[model samples]
Target: MSRIRATLVATAAAAAALLAPLAAAPAASAHGWITSPESRQGFCAEGATSFDCGEIKYEPQSVEAPKGSTKCSGGSSYTILDDNSKPWPRTTTGTTVTFQWKLTAAHSTASWEYFLDGVLYRTFDGGNKQPPSNVSQTIEGLPTGDHTMLVRWNIADTANAFYSCVDLHVVAGGTDPGDGGTTTPPVTTSPTDPTTPTSPGTCSAAAWSSSSVYLGGDQASYNGQIYRANWWTQGDTPSNTAWGPWTLVGSC
Candidate 1:
C-alpha cells in the first residue's frame, strides 16, 4: 500500500509542474527608429507685413512636415485658407501622444488652432515675434488609429503655411487619467476576470479596435504565450503571402 501511494504522489507532482503557468514574455521591441532625416527646403520670414507674414514657425518639432505656420509681428488678417489645410497620413486614438517640431520664427500673436480628423481639439498662441526654433507638443489627444492632425496658423490665409503630420501613432490604451484600477478590454478570448470593472461603456475583450481586423495567422507571441500556427486564423492575416499559421480566436 505504501509503495502504491508513493507512485501516485510522484505522478501528481509531475502533472502539477506541467500545468503550471509560465511568466509573460517581453513585448517585441519596437525597431527602426527614424535613422535619417529628410532634407527641408527651409524658408524663413520674420517681422514682415500682416496677411503676408511677419514671423512664423513650423509647429511640433518633426522631420516629415514640409510647410508650417507663420506668425505675424503686427495686425491680424490671419484667416482664410483654401490651400492652407493639410494632414498627416497617420492614425490617432487612445489617450495621447507627444510630437517633436521646430520653428523658424515666432508669430507676433504666437497662437495656433489645431484640428484632429476635422474636429477641433485645441488652440494656443506662439507668443512674441520670436525667432523660429524647436518646440514640443502643442496639442494632444485625437482618436486612435489613422488620423489627420492639421495645425493651421492662418486658417483664412495660406501664405502663413501649415504643418501636417503624415503618420501619428496614437498607440492604444485610452484609459482615463483620473481613474485607477482600470483594465484594458480583452479581445477574442474572454478576459481572465469578467467581474473586474472596466471603464464605463468600454467594449468587451472580444471586441477588436477599428484598426485591428481579424485574419488568419501562423503564430503569435502574446504576453510570452506562444500560440502556434494553423490554417484559417481569426486574429489576423499572415504578413506573408502563404497561409498556414492560424490565429485562433472566438469567432462566434
Candidate 2:
C-alpha cells in the first residue's frame, strides 16, 4: 500500500507539470480576414472555385504587414492575393452594402478603411478597443460597376495591419452579377519584365523616401521594382524579404 501511494503521487505530479504550460499560455493576438463578399483571402481559405490561389487558400487570417500599405495581402507571403491576373469571384451588391469580417482572435483596433480603386471610400474608427468576433460596416454611394475593395484593419497597439481584398460588382438596381461577373482590371505587372508598363491610370511608382510617411495604397519604386505600401511606414526597404511593409507589385 505504501508503494502504490508513492507511485500515484508521482503520476499526479507529472500530470500537473504537463498542464502548467497550457494554463499559463497567453491569449492569442487578433487574427482574422474578411468573409462577406468573399475577400480574396477568404475565398482562398474556402477553396475558391473560380481561380487557383496560392498559400492563402489555407490561412486567410495570416495576411498581415505593417500599417500604411495598400496591397491586398499587406506584403505577406500570401502574395497570391495581389495577383490580379486571375479572375476572382465577385459579390454583387447595391450602392450601399454591409461588409463583414470574421475574426478568430479579436484585437483592439485603430481603424478600418475601405479602398475602391486605390481611393478611400469609407473608414470606421475602432476607438482603440477590442471588437466582436464578427465586425460589420456599411458603405454607401459606390458607383455602379466592378470595383476592387480592399478592407484594412489597423491595430491600435501593434505596428501591423490586416488586409483582405473583395472584388465587388455593384449594381444600381439590377439583378445580381453572381460569381461569374466582370473582372477588375489587373494592376500588377509581369515579373518577367520589371520595366513593363502597367495599365493606364494605375498607381505610378515613385522613389521610396525614408522621411516620407507612406499611407495605404501608396506606390514606390525600389531596386528596379514597383512596391505598394500596406500601411503607414518609413525606413523599411522594399526588398525580397517577406512580411516587410512593401509588397512587390511588379518590376519598375
TM-score (all chains, Cα) for each model = 0.30, 0.58
Alpha-carbon error at 89 in model 1, in Å?
A: 5.7
Which lDDT tens digits does candidate 2 get at residues 58-133? Answer: 5677778889888997887778788888788888888776677766668899999999977888899999999886
Q: Evaluate all candidate structures by whole-model CA lDDT and list the values in order.
A: 0.33, 0.72
lDDT per residue for candidate 1 within 134-240, as digits (tens), equals: 33342444566655455444322223334432234455685322112222222223342322323343222333322443221223434322332222234453232
lDDT of residue 112 for candidate 1: 53
Model 1 lDDT at residue 169:
47
Tell me the TM-score of model 1.
0.30
lDDT of 2 at 60: 70
